[model samples]
Target: MKWWLIIILSLSIAFLGCEKTDKPTINEDGTKDNGKLESGGKNPKSKTGVWLTDWNDAMKTADVLNRPVFVDFTGSDWCIWCQKLEEEVFGKGEFLEYAKKNLVLLKVDFPRDIEQSEELQKFNEQKMKEYEIEGFPTIVLVNSKGEEIARTGYRPGGAKEYVKHLQELLQPKE
Candidate 1:
């Protein structure tokens, strides 16, 4: 019985000692170790959207994946709500993880207060016209074929709720 108990304990410890699939590590300096951030490290993988400088590049990438594109339109430098979304939503570990999994993130930023590359500015304007964005921080969900599926702005919620919201967006509209 003692031998059996030892075996079980060993197995338990081994399993527990394994690193989580993708949980960010806490660094000794009180910072999260983003570790070769897959998507700019600004947004976690669970949260699928990412900031993109060029819509054409995004479209090409999305085409290859055959996944729907979820775009986050924000004024990264000049908008208070955009800042809040970054801090309260994307900054949260849970939300970032959820985003990385479900959808293909694409960010279209128009920062009026900051100097943006002329090429990037042109791309943002083109996508804004293409998507007909009316406000800051518009989260637009599109189908695999580039068809618009749904749209929303940031709202109060946790990671689970955000996951549910994204899943609902992916569902077929009646």
Candidate 2:
């Protein structure tokens, strides 16, 4: 009886630890530490519609293209909202075309299942600290020098509306 209860409790705790499948949790410092991210490296001109996970590479691409960097800080594998945003906005043709023309896309992710290189994990953790990331799916727009110009998160809308929202955010405020 007592042994059975203890065993069940332990199993529950084990299952609940790390990357909550039912709910999203943030650390005391407001950083997301769940899910996983995969690398998607490709040439900007290829127009294959993917993101670069390397920070330095993204900056270089932005410089070469004279464009801002769209940095997506996400828990790509576990964050439900992140997945929805990708499906409803990022993966669509409207945003893809807009992004291809105007931005160098970068993905910095905190994942659970996948094994990120130690260097990559360190670099990404440092970036989270530098950016003061609050939660999964935080998006920051930056210039070629990698200075942030604007920030936003998951918003309700499809790709076309999302493009409009981005256009508004990109507009110069006088």
Clashing pairs in 2: 35-111, 35-112, 36-111
Instruction: Encode model 1's per-residue lDDT on 1-174: one tens digit a residue.
Output: 999999999999899977477676775445575663444434233223555555655555565445667788999888888787777777776766665445577778888778888988887798788989999889888765667889887776754566677778778767
Q: Report lDDT (CA) for all predictions.
A: 0.70, 0.82
What root-mean-square deviation over C-alphas does model 1 reach? 12.4
Best by lDDT: 2
lDDT at residue 11 of model 2 (Cα atoms): 90
- List model 2 lDDT by residue over 1-174, tens digit each: 999999999998888765446343564436453432223433335422459898988886677667888999999999999999999999999999888778888999898887899999999999999999989899999997878899998999799999999999999989
* Prediction 2 TM-score vs. true: 0.73
RMSD for each of the candidates: 12.4, 16.5
lDDT measured at residue 97 in model 1 versus the true structure, 0 to 100: 62
- Total clashing pairs in model 1: 13
Give each model a TM-score: 0.64, 0.73
**Model 2 per-residue lDDT at 34:** 42
